[model samples]
Structure formats: C-alpha cells, structure tokens
Target: MRPARTTVATAVAAVAALTAVTGCADKTDAASGGKGGPAVHVTAKDDSCAVSTASFAAGHVQLAVENQGSRVTEVELLFPDGRIATERENLGPGTRATVTAEVKAGTYNIACIPGMKGQGIRKKVTVTGGTAERRDPAKDAAVDAYRAYAQAQADATLPKVKTFTDAVRAGDIPAARKAFAPSRVGWERTEPVAESFGDIDPKTDTRADGLEDGQKWTGWHALEKQLWQDKKLSADSKALADQLDKDLADWQQRVGRAEITPTSMANGAKELLDEVATNKITGEEDRYSHTDLSDFQANVDGAQKAYELLKPVARKNDPALSAELDKQFAAIDTLLAKYHDSHSSDGFVAYTKVAPAQRKQLSDGVNALAEPLSKLAAAVVK
Candidate 1:
C-alpha cells in the first residue's frame, strides 16, 4: 500500500476525528499474552532463531518468541507447507511475545523474522506423538478461510502495486496519484494476515510518523511525499518506486504460503478495525495524502471477509451473535454507501467531507461490530 503526497481529497478525516473521540487508537496496544500452556521460548537473533527444542507433542502449546537481536524481530511456527501453526510478530528489541496454539502430530519449522522486515531465518523441527488428535471442523474451516483470504489479497494487490510503481518510475504523476488509493485497497483489506510478514508491511506502507528515529523511510509513503506534495517526479521517486516494486514482489511470493487459523483471522479482523478506529479515523495514517477513506473501506471489507469465512463457525456456536454481526455489518454498509469520496475512483466523499455526526455514526457502527467480532476467534476456537 503506497501513499501519495497531497491533501485529503475525500473528507474521511472526519472518521478519524470521531475515532479519536471514541478512544479506538489504544486498541493497538492490546496483546494476547498467552497463559497456561507450557511456554516454548524462542530467541531471535540477526542470524538465527534460537529455540530450546525441535519437538512438540500434538496438543495445546504456548510459544514465546524473544527479540534478542538489536533490530526488531518475529518468530513463526510453520508446517511443511509454510502454514503458520502459531506466530509472534513485531517484538521490539529485548521485548518478548507469545503464540498459543494446538498442534497435531506433524513436522514444523521455525521462521525467524529479523529486522521486523525481510524473509526471516528458517529452521526445522519434529512434532512427536500425543493422543489421537482430531481437527475441529470449525477451526479447520477457519484455517482454510484465512489461507484463501491471504492468497486472494496478495494475488489481487501485487499486480496493482507494480502498475502503480511503473507509473511512478515513468514519471506519470497524475496516473500514479489516481492509482494510489484503489491499489492499496487490496493491502488494506488483508491487513491482519499481510502484516504477519514482519518487514514487508512496514516497507510497503509504513508512514513517516510511525517511523522511529534512524529508521530509513522507504516504501509507498516515501514515494507519496514526492508524488502529491512536490507534484514533481525525480530519481528519488523512481528509486523508492523501484524498491517498492521489489518489496511487493517479495511479499506476493511470501504471503498465503503460511497456514491460517480461525483465531488469528478473527483477531486480525478486529485489529483491522482497530487500525481504522485509531489511524484511519484519526488521520494519523493518511497524514500525507487524505485518502484515508479508501484504506478505511478496504479494512472494513477485509474484516467483513474474515467474518464471512467464519460465519459457519459463529452460527454454530452462537446464532444470536452471528445474526447480530450480520446486522452490524449491514448497517456499516448502508452508512458507507452514502459516503462520497472526491479523489478516489470510487465515489466515497473526501475524508473531511463527512460530518462529525455521521463519522461518529460510522465509528459507533464499527465499535459495535468489534464487540461481536472480538468474540469470534474464541467462540469458534472453542
């Protein structure tokens, strides 16, 4: 997802203002903090993802990945097909995170993501015997849903980024500007799963404000500065464009190769809204360009997709909740349908165009969905 330099054409900033009023930004601080299961400690370094053992029995397991490296890192447990049995990501230096999972008797690998970016370090492992473990249908279905969701987003968004970058490289300012928001829809829609790649998300779409000191800003927003703000094209733009092209290609190849689960999908869906609740709504994300609406809509779309995938599980677990979620999503749909964006190819209005009252209406709608969506992972996993 790339940003262009410019003002908010679609007045979606109102959505952000309401989000701030509603205190949604704090959602990013939420953590799973796994409890109970035997904690498997995995230490991540620049060169290696150090783990105590390579064997896990078929059952519930809690894995903690510690970022011992100077740069941020993440650890993932992958089965043979690159499916994530469990993962803990974005652990800053010296910070530790955990992944609680139930694994069957199968071989697994450890993917050590370094620098909070890049194709991480990989290692092998063996999962030994346990009780005759059976896969829960709902959980199994959710895994499939997440896998399809990840792959679909990658496939849809990858080519779009290339086209956008090509316009940037060729100095087609107007074309790239128009391509910016729509192209990001794919990435935004896949936020929860796509972000698991450690470095790629930051590289593709990290905002300048989110960057720590000394962090080299490169990616979509890097090009966004030149494209919309300066309204001029140069080597700087082309270079960032080229780098973005490479990073996107890498991401396209890497995503969807990992296993998906219901819990993560539900969790990811909620997190997507949290992003909207905090950044998109508050305009912290679309700082340079005011196209927050496109991203905002895409996030809701992605979250909706996750919910759709898990609908069966939800219905089986709690019909009332499932019905309520449907109505909640429908309400947002009706609300957003009325939004008219000026810059976006779609007709949604400028982020700033929507009134605070209307923005609050949408915010409340999302928060409502979040309540039921939040319970999805646990309800289905159970």
Candidate 2:
C-alpha cells in the first residue's frame, strides 16, 4: 500500500466485489394474513418506545410512528435476517408517519431509529392467528454479497490499522495522523453490520463527545484526540492503538456471520449516507485532524458499493428507483472527484482545503443521493 499521505484513501475492497450481490431476485410476500388487523400507534421519544399496544392480531397491520423527540427519527418493523417489513425515515419532531405491512402470528419488534442513527431502539410486538414467511439465508445472493463485502472491508481494515498502530507505537505522531482517517474507511462503510455486534462498535467508533459519563473513550475518536489535539503519543496511546488493531481482527471473524440481505444492503447504504449527512460533511468528526474529507469520501464509496450490489435486484423490483439511484450515485461520485488528490488519483484533497461553497456542493450532493437511497429499502425488499 502507498504511504498514508500518498494513498488516495478509497476503500479499494469495495469495487472488486460490489457487483457480487447480483441475481437473487424473487423475493415475494406469500404469507397468509387473517382479517385486517388493527393500527398500532407508536410514540418515539428521545429514548423510549411508548406503544399503544404490544399485542395485535396477525394480518395487514398499520404501524404509525410519531416522533416526539427533537432530532429526526424513523420506525421500522424488524423481520429475521435483517428484513424490514416496513419502515418510515426522517420524520421530524411532532410529525407522524405510517406503513401498512403483512404481519404474521409471531413476535416482532418496533425498531425506532432515533436521531436516525446508531443501532436504534427496539420494542417487541406480538401477533397471533396468521402465518409469516421465513427468509432462507441460503437463497439470498445479496446476503452472500453483503457478507463478502464485510469480509473485504475487514481484511482491508486490519493492514491499515496495523500501519497506523505501528506508527503510534513507534511514537511517530505525524505518520499515525496521516494514516488514521484512511484506516477507518472500511469500517465506517461496513457500519450497518459492524455496529450490530455487541460492544465492539461502541468501543471502536464512539465519538469522544458522545461517550457516556462512565465510558472509557476509545476507537478512532480517542486516538484522534491524542494525535490531533494532544499532538503526541505515550505508552497508553500505543496500547490504545494495539487494542484497536486487536479489536478489528476479532471483529473480522464475525463479519462472515453477519446478517446480510437485499434489505440489509439497501438499509446499510441509506444509513451510511445518514452518517455523511449527520457528521462527516459537517466537518465535525475530524475536527482535530481535518481528515473529514477523506472519511466523507470513504462513506460515499461505501454507500455506493452497497447500492451497486443491490442495483440488479432493485432494477428488477423497481426500475424507476433503480434508475434514480443510478443517476444520484453517478452525480455524487462526479462531484466528489472534483476534490481528488492531485498527487494520488484515488486520494482526495485535504478536508481543510475544501472551500465553504464546495463543502455545500458536497453536502447537497450527499443529500440528493440520500433521498434515492432512502427509497431503496422499500424497493429492493421484494
């Protein structure tokens, strides 16, 4: 790999296999439903699920999610294998939205994606008297594609992390800083799957500012603080770097076992865009190192990879959406490329170098891509 400063920082693993999630087409809802079921009204507070009822008769049920919190939020019906029966995204405060879905006689969860980020909060809901279709992992080409994509990301991540950690352990602060943002690219792209694993996500990705009172801040942000803010590394910093490498290696083993599906690929793509809108484009994340642009490019690349894998399925299921996504992804890619590094064709300019107007252009591009991506989950879950 090129030296950190010379690397273009695109997650190279994506393009090679992004096309693998092709041809698992026929996903249909063949489940039997009882008489039309009742509407279940749900209230999403900042951190709570105030459900009108936790039990319902299994049939065509209506789910209404009202966002009572300050930040934007969404609601999803969690099915096994990462399938979402129905979901509503980006509902603002005091707003309500609903989705009609065929539900079966089984226990399900009302997943509240508060602030439209993180793992989301889940509330259990049960239904009775009808049957639900079970998803076969074996038949899901998209899931296979997703698992492979994750493995690629992990494999890509370890070496980058090792480079960064080695720099830190060697007390080479400048070299470590140069390597930091690029190293985080793969993991950030695979976040939809990575964050699902217990504890590891928080341990590795949590923002120093977002840490709970008692939480020991680790991961990229912790290291970012030391490298960019403190501007030096000590023995404890070396240990932190080593721990990050170890954690990523351990997490790579869990990548293959991750739940990947057409629905997951679609949702993960949308969520990665959310990360861009929520943080990266704002220049908030890499405040210390000014590496936000690299991360921004990485996030976009990650989302595009997922979109690429699901494109064939989406085209079969919903051609209009597929076309729109195609256009949006292409436009965003072009806009981002304007910031490409002169020295490294694959790398981009420093985040600090981006002008305010160009930043808006990038943000607008991301928002445009996000709108189409938001519709992807519903379109590909055929």
Candidate 3:
C-alpha cells in the first residue's frame, strides 16, 4: 500500500463546516503593523490548541505554528465555509514552522490536530478590516491560469475513469490493467486541487491499508488490487467500480468551485513533488500494476503546470530560483524518459523493472526540485 497520502488538510477542510463545534476561547494579541505582514502565533499541545491572537486585520498573515505536544500535529487556517486558507502538518514536538496566506475580512478557524488526526481543536477567529491584497495583475493571472488547468484536469479524468471502471464491471482483467495507469494521469497531476474538497481523495484513491477503521476499500486502487493482485472480480468488485465512477464525477463537478490563490497554487506544486518523493518514487502508489512512473510523470506534469503559470511573478521576484527550478525540472524529465515504453499500458517501463540505482536517481531528482519549489509560495506572494 502507498504511504497514505491521506492529506489531513483535505479531510479537515471538508468536514469542518458541517460538524465543527462552536465557541472556543479567542486568543487575541495586538496585530502586527510592521513589515512582513501580521503574525499569528499558534501552539499545539496534546490537550490544548492555543493561538497568540484570534482576531486581526485582513491581508497577508504569517501563522507561526509550534507543536509542544508529544505527537506530531497539524495546524490550519480555515475559511468559514471550511476551505483551507493555509495549513502546516507533521509538526513534531518542539518544532516550529510558519504558514503564509492571504485572507479577506471574514470569520475563520484556527484548527490544531494533534497526531494529525480528527477535526482538531478549533478556535473561532475574526478578520477585521478590508482586503489587504496586493493589486498585482501577474498574481491574478497566475491564479486564473492555475484554476483553469485544474478544472481541465478534473474534466479529463472523469471519462478516463469511466472507461477503466467499465472494464472492471466487465471483469476483463487485461483491458482493465491497460486502462488503469492512463486513468490516473489526470488525477495525479491535479491531486492537491482534488484533495482540497474533503474525503474525495480518500474515497477515490486510498489504498487498502490507507483506509481508516471501518472505511470501505473502494476506488481506483481497490479495483487495481482486485485485477492485478487477486486476479479475480467478484460482485463486490463491480459495485466498487460504480462507486468509483460516482466519486470521480463528484470531483469533476466540484473542482471548478475550489478556492484558488497565487500562494495556494505555489504550495500545491510543492505538495505534488512531495507526493512523488514519498510515494511514487518508492513504487508504493501503483504496487499492484507497477505503473508508478505514469503517476510520477503526471505529478511532475501538474507541478510544472502550476510553476509555469506562476512563473512571471516568480521570475520577476526571484530569477535565480526560477532558473534553478527550470534546470531541475528538465533533469527529471530527461530521467523519466529513459523509462519510456511506447507500447506499454502507461507509456513507461513497469516500476518492477526500475533498478534500485535508477530509483535512487529519481529520488534525488525529486528532492532537488522540491527544495526550490518550496520557495515558490513566498516568491510569488512578493
């Protein structure tokens, strides 16, 4: 099973609106009026979630998050509707990080998830004053372009998934296997956007072991296992196929409604590279089919699309970073092409055929790209 790319950011944002409990203490401090934007300090302990300030002037804000708890924690800035304004996860005890986001005047939540699980400790926050956004045309263009790309990926995925599911329903193992990797290309490319919708990624993409207790195994990987690992299709397999189709359709319909911003696009691009480094490069994502390279390429494709759209602003703000990103991206692309297979189901050699040394090279390339990619959010916001 894949090392559960279970994005808690995706899950909490999805559930917060419907089930979020009301009324926690608001920790307020004097809003920062100096350079580098307002600073909101967040402390996450096993038993309590605390913030230095809960109310502040709206605009660009830096959430300085610290985990004082034994367990690793996640902290999020959420809109009233449960959309993520920004979030940081895997904060081990005594560690700290800063999350930057653009927020408008509205009500919001600062949620701290100890152990990076559940709805988290919630505190209501109020944003006073009007938009403090920089009126940059390049920033607006970047957001618009990335949103359109994300929507297009979602639209393309539904039909491909439908074809894969159709083969599953027919119990045609060979045909289903052929369709599997191609079907996932779009989803892998725009995963962070799809994941933003709550529970959708879990429903459609979770591996067997990735499931929570009592959660049914469904969607692409569930069927992949049935086809390649189990080598038999039961009535349950057909039923799973139908459910997968429905979930993907829901994703397509809702992707257009996702809240996108320049910083989110930049952050999301880095998230895709992280997906490759931790999961795809390990060949854990497509364990049964051994088609990990397809997913790897798709993740790169998505990350590159976001980076390209944000490039004008990013290049202007940090040309050196932009040049390095270009070099690393091209290096990875060249490395992947060595595994290309024109006649294969996913247009790449099976992951099982990728030698250990080759996999290490791939891993190194992703890490190389990811370092500079992480700076994208801050660069574009400038």
Q: For residues 172-276, write the lDDT of model 2, one tens digit per residue.
A: 887887788779888877876775554577678776655555777677778888888887765589778878987888888888876465655766776677667
Q: Is candidate 2 or candidate 3 better by TM-score?
A: 3
lDDT of 1 by residue, 193-309 (tens): 666654577677887754545777888777777777777876678888888878877877877565456666776776676677656765557666677777888888998998988
Candidate 3 stretches with Cα past 4 Å from truth are 1-35, 70-72, 92-95
Residue 16 local lDDT, model 3: 28
Q: Which stretches of candidate 2 lie over 4 Å from their true place?
A: 1-41, 46-48, 52-64, 71-92, 95-122, 127-139, 344-346
Q: How accurate locally is residue 57 in candidate 2, as Cα lDDT from 0 to 100?
A: 80
Question: Best candidate, TM-score-wise?
Answer: 3
Question: Candidate 2 local accuracy as lDDT?
Answer: 0.67
Candidate 1 has its poorest 10 consecutive residues by lDDT at 24-33
Model 2 root mean square deviation, Cα atoms: 9.0
Local distance difference test values of all predictions, in order? 0.68, 0.67, 0.77
The residue-by-residue lDDT of candidate 3 on 118-212, one tens digit each, is 67899999998955655788888888878888889888888888888899888888999999999999899998787776568888888765677
lDDT of 3: 0.77
